[model samples]
Target: MASTIISKDKFQFTDTIREHLAFGIVLTCLFLFLTSAYTKIEEHDRFMNGLLKVAFISHYAWLISWTVPVAEIVVSLFLIIPKTHKWGLYGFIGLMMVFTIYIGSMLLWSEKLPCHCNLLIEKLSWGEHVVFNLAFVGLAAFALWLIKNNQYKSLIKQNDKY
Candidate 1:
């Protein structure tokens, strides 16, 4: 039927859109994580000092100074590989959530807020940083949703063919 063909075309168009959007989100997160890791590595001493200024995390600054950048790089690697893209998105979401929570906590409880680890946008206030991180979290989450939805639809299509 014409209606059926039209519906198929519509579905294909939307699926294409979703695929493109997901790809864009993945690339954006990849670039962000890679650049952030590079910046931290380049300014290792200053980054460590900034972490040391934070009252709660000052004790573990030595360990965290190395860990954070390494984790970022690992997540970037995960994002670069097609098979691991889903896990990479998960890692990205988890990292952003942690960063957002840390910033929010600092804003609420810390008497003197230390320099933020976000090398990309140093001028953003703590609140803005939270919002910024949350935005990326939302985008990544949306991309995951789209991917899941497409997989579900594919399964349904396969079932319908049987």
Candidate 2:
């Protein structure tokens, strides 16, 4: 009878799995941003009016009404291209963080909850909206970590060869 020892480096399934998971997360975020942007564009008047109802940003409603959708579209484009995917994830995380903070502020300080979100997101309550945005932010951040970790590991392996 022969005994075989398995070394850690001999198995790379974890790396492959992590890469796939990161890709899946990026794709999900891309879909979400693109859909949200499309909805805002399609219902521009309604979204702008909703933005106007929020007291803090009501003054800048005109600017934000256009900027939000445009930002979302641009971020989605970044996610679509492989070269810019990492930056897209960072953009996604930043946008989601801002959105989550906005929702939290609305919940804490505002008398009325005003949501200028897309169709599906519009259905969520203020608290649920906060949770939802935070969840995306977390997922995007995690995907970014995984990507960076994988890159670091690859660099280490390349260095070891020399």
Candidate 3:
């Protein structure tokens, strides 16, 4: 007995957009996992200086405790699976946008000689931080642009010629 394949025309190019965005988002977040671990060992002073930056915020510790590592881990897995990749990209974009804002805030407030926020933070000065985040924002914006122009979204706008 032989098995036959059937095509139902379920959804067009949904997988492509998901793959592109997922690829970008996951590779981007990989920087986080590497940076977090790298700074702790390779450079201590910069790391300490960064923590000093956030030390005054009462909730900072808890935020770090739960948000950073967990987000890094969860998103990594979520993005790896094809079924979850689309939604995962959505979540990743949202989180990264929010992070860009935080980076912007740090740059704006640097006049007070505010701490850099961590050792990895030392890798980029205030000006550098803003530039880095803007670059990330640009990446996400491009992904959105691609998604909007994608076959799935645009194909839906066309008339069936059959």
**Candidate 1's TM-score:** 0.89
Q: Against the correct fold, how does model 2 do in TM-score?
A: 0.89
- On the 0 to 100 scale, the lDDT of residue 93 in model 1 is 97
Global CA lDDT computed for model 1: 0.88
Candidate 1: regions farther than 4 A off: 1-13
Off by over 4 Å in 3: 1-49, 52-56, 110-122, 151-162
lDDT of 3: 0.56
lDDT of 2 by residue, 9-101 (tens): 456447888899999999999999999999989989988898888888999998998898999999999999988989999999998888888
What is each predicted model's overall lDDT from 0 to 1? 0.88, 0.88, 0.56
Q: Report the candidate with higher lDDT, 2 versus 3.
A: 2
Rank by lDDT (best first): 1, 2, 3
- Give each model a TM-score: 0.89, 0.89, 0.56
Count of steric clashes across candidates, in order? 0, 0, 4
Highest lDDT scorer: 1
Q: How many Å off is the CA of 51 in candidate 2?
A: 1.3
Candidate 1 at 88: error in angstroms? 0.6
